[model samples]
Target: MRRLASGPDILLLAAVWIVDVAVFSTLLNRSDSPSGLLRAPVVVGYAAVGAAALLLRRSHPVWVFAAVWLHSCAANLLPLGVHPTAGVLVALYTVTASRGEAVGALAMVAGFVPLGLTVAAEVRAAAADERITILTANAIFFTVVGLLVWGLGRWVRANREHARELERRRLAEADAAVAVERRRIARELHDIVAHAVTVMVLQAGGAQQILGTDAARALRTLRQIEDLGREAMGELRRLLLVLRPSAGDEAQQPVDGHQPGLDDVDRLVGTFREASLPVRLGVCGAARRMDRSTDLTAYRVVQEALTNVMKHAGPGTRTRVELNWADALSIRVTDDGGSPPRRASAPSAGHGLLGLQERVDVVGGTLTAGPTRDGGFEVNAALPVPTTEPDRARSGG
Candidate 1:
């Protein structure tokens, strides 16, 4: 940082100051031949003060103004330099860029007072026997410069404040979006694992009633229920982790590995099949591979769609699951006919589609669910295939 601060970049601004002094000194000499008061050493002193003011311009804007004021008074009184006020202009610019409005305003008034006095004194002395036009002109110039400096400072501060405000608003919007995503995720867990576990417990009990005659089959059914409970817990843990990366005691671990893919669809469809629901599963296009997140989303979308079917369309409904892996992966689940054999004990359990919609949105995909013309419920979903490794890497990474 020290090296950067001391680097040659600042020499450019220093050079401009030096050039201004040389030209103005030449003009002063041309306009007023060496009145013995205008000596080389005195002119050099004025330049030294102006250069020093420029050196600490950013760090000490008020000090720069003070130094330039002293130099300006000397130059103008003897008219030793034609451009007496350029160093003051530089100081004004420094205050504009760095200082706050109230402080800059104080510095402006402080600088203008001494400056106007010096010009007024010079005018009184130089135009002793002349009209007062020169004095009025000098006063007007001082007032204009004071107003200009104050205006510049105000403008810069306003712009800086506006930029900061915009940044704050943008961050607020991002936080709100994340909060909304978390709420939707919570709702999905309530419907999926919570409902699935309840159904599994009930199914396991039913299997036990005929346990003696079909003892082996009953055990197999019990095991399937245990497997499902574990699966739901695993999915639940993963969803919790994704929602809360920083969750500690509250942290629910993410499902460690990727979400199950097309291969796992068979296992999912088989769960209902074992329960004696007629389920037809279909696949099209290449069974393209994908990241775990999309697989999870696909899993959840299918899971919720099916869950809704069983909840609303009822038990013994014929369900069809289709996976199309063409340009993008598409999932469709249709219940051509199945109203719960009996009305469900719970009627409000069909709201899982809200969670499904959020899952699809996270992947920049889309999902839609509604009744079909053929007297069935249909869920049609399309998830964009992450076409490149970079995109997949970003989501996975």
Candidate 2:
């Protein structure tokens, strides 16, 4: 609530004052009686004060209503008779609009009290025949107008509350969308950087061991490292574009030519094998077409699982990856326990499984990873595939 009146409040006060003064002057003009003319200035002065009270109606609705009520009663009791004035009705509207139903109901009854008393006084002073008619008409008219004004105020209050509720809902939805996007960006960073760095470390170590005895093999390993490094840089550039892209780059391709999916799993396994981590790939059932998100999630599950084996397992550890295409695509990557590494295991930040779970969830899949009974580790995932698409096209078919 405002402590001081606003522009609209001043305008409303001016409008009501003009209306009240005009009506009072018109009644005074029609009556040529000397007593009515003498009281004219006093009535206008009191009406001015009531209209001015409207300025503070929003801040002090109850008090404003009381002042206006007194002004209306004085008009009737002082023999310059007027029905309940516009000031009293405006005050009633403010009370109901600002203070709500229970308080507004009280204000309505308070407003009618003075009018009732003035009417009863007039009926007693009049002739016996005219008393009943005056009482009935005034009572009916005033009650109906009072209820309509109160109801209009309540309608305005309800509309304001409804608008506020819609604004709150819109803000909440925006916040939730921001949180989800941050998690997705975090997941992408972990998957791309972690896997590439792990492969490079193993390749570097393998090259160092054979550098002097077999120069040719060392050279080949270094070339693979150079190629892998370039690929990682390209992927990072693509991810960066997603984070903060220039207008020109909006039409550019994502990273290299095409995004990696299930079809690229074989090449992914080949990359790990080149780094001296023994890997074998197997497939069963006819592969079916999948949506982009589900295809990418399936590939990532295998990539993350194999990357984990290289990071935490021994040097001679062997990994097997299986893809079972069915109504739902089922994937499994298992690593056989091997001789302990000659050096300390690589450091782990442990975001692999956590990110994998979130990615799998996005595509409506389930992922589980744990040590097997045979002293090996295994990651298993089942991703649902939409059957409404064409069968996956195989090369040279």
Candidate 3:
């Protein structure tokens, strides 16, 4: 019932009914001819039916327009005389609003025929001087009113379509952004877990090999493995915290607590040395504090390159990690060790290089990783340094 007659529907129905009553009353009071009086009841009944048809206009706009239009024409044809009612205009607006431009044009043309005919009838009954005046005035008045109503409906329909199109574009952009962010998060997780576990594996293997021959060294290796495990767990927890929504006191804690930066690269190198890899670190040019993101990317590049060396170059490889700080930071990790040793659980997804490339690109940097001419592998990256106000002031314009 509510769908059939909403609040606006009831109000429209009442308005149309009132217009019908007013038109009928005016016809009865204005005319004095006996023939006109006799036809008055028929015209009044026709107007009532046309106005009632407005109730279904929203559901069947074209059909309602045709029905109301035919009834209006029949009423006008009667000798008694009838005037244009609100029902005709209402039906015309509904057709234009719902049926689009092509059908609305047809309805407009159909409506014009009756109006022209009514004007012609009025002209035939007037004196010669008044005939021309009445014809011109009625033609101009009806044409202007009809076109205004039709144009208003078309304008409203166009605005509604435009709004819907904007909403669709907004939702599509949002979905694309979400997909890109998911890929980024996946890459970050891979880098963190892969590097940490690889070191742990090397330490465990060293502990196993030296257990019978050297008890003190084996125990030291085991302790190192425990420390690596605890560090990995802490990093994993931080990553997980980002996914969970916080409440109360937890909300105040930072999501990233002491994220690794360039300063931590020395510590990272120490861990690899403990795993029995002979690694060298070289720094050239002056070192200065860099932006958080650039610092993080530089650290990850070194970390990933060293991890790859551990996996592919095997133990006892002479590896070199170089950091050249100039206009941009240049990182290169190279190993003299040959092919990788086969292992049962050598964690591989083939996404390590790809993830490194993505991280480099995000900081407007470039990364190159492939075999070197020396029968070894090399990973090189160049990351741009972000300028700060202090640097600008010191350099001078």
- Number of the top candidate by TM-score? 1
Candidate 2 residue 286 Cα shift, in angstroms, is: 39
Error of 3 at 44 (Å): 3.8
Clashes of each: 3, 0, 0
lDDT of each: 0.65, 0.72, 0.71
Per-prediction TM-score to the true structure, in the order listed:
0.55, 0.50, 0.50
Clashing pairs in 1: 238-254, 238-255, 314-340
Model 1, span 1-397: residue lDDT tens: 3332354536735664665456545444443566534555555566656765677776777777777777766666565543455567667766766777777777676677556755665465564655377677777887787778668877887888899999898666544454555554554554566766887988888797869899888888888898777767755775664465321122122465233555566787788777676788877656555544566688777767777777676668888888777678899988865653323333232335654565677556788877765567788999877564322111100
Scored against the true structure, residue 166 in model 2 reaches a CA lDDT of 93
* Preferred candidate (TM-score higher): 1 or 3: 1
Say which prediction, candidate 1 or candidate 3, comes out ahead on lDDT.
3
lDDT agreement of model 1 with the native: 0.65
Question: Which prediction has more favorable TM-score, 1 or 2?
Answer: 1
lDDT of predicted model 3? 0.71
lDDT of 2 by residue, 1-397 (tens): 5457778878888778767666633345545777767666765676677788788787888988998888777766666544336788899988888886799889878878765765665576568999899788867876888889888889988888889899897655544443444345444644665677789999999999999999999999999899778757755654553353212111112365355788888788888888898888888777787655567778879988988888778556988888887788899998875564322224232456655676676556898877776667888999988675547643210
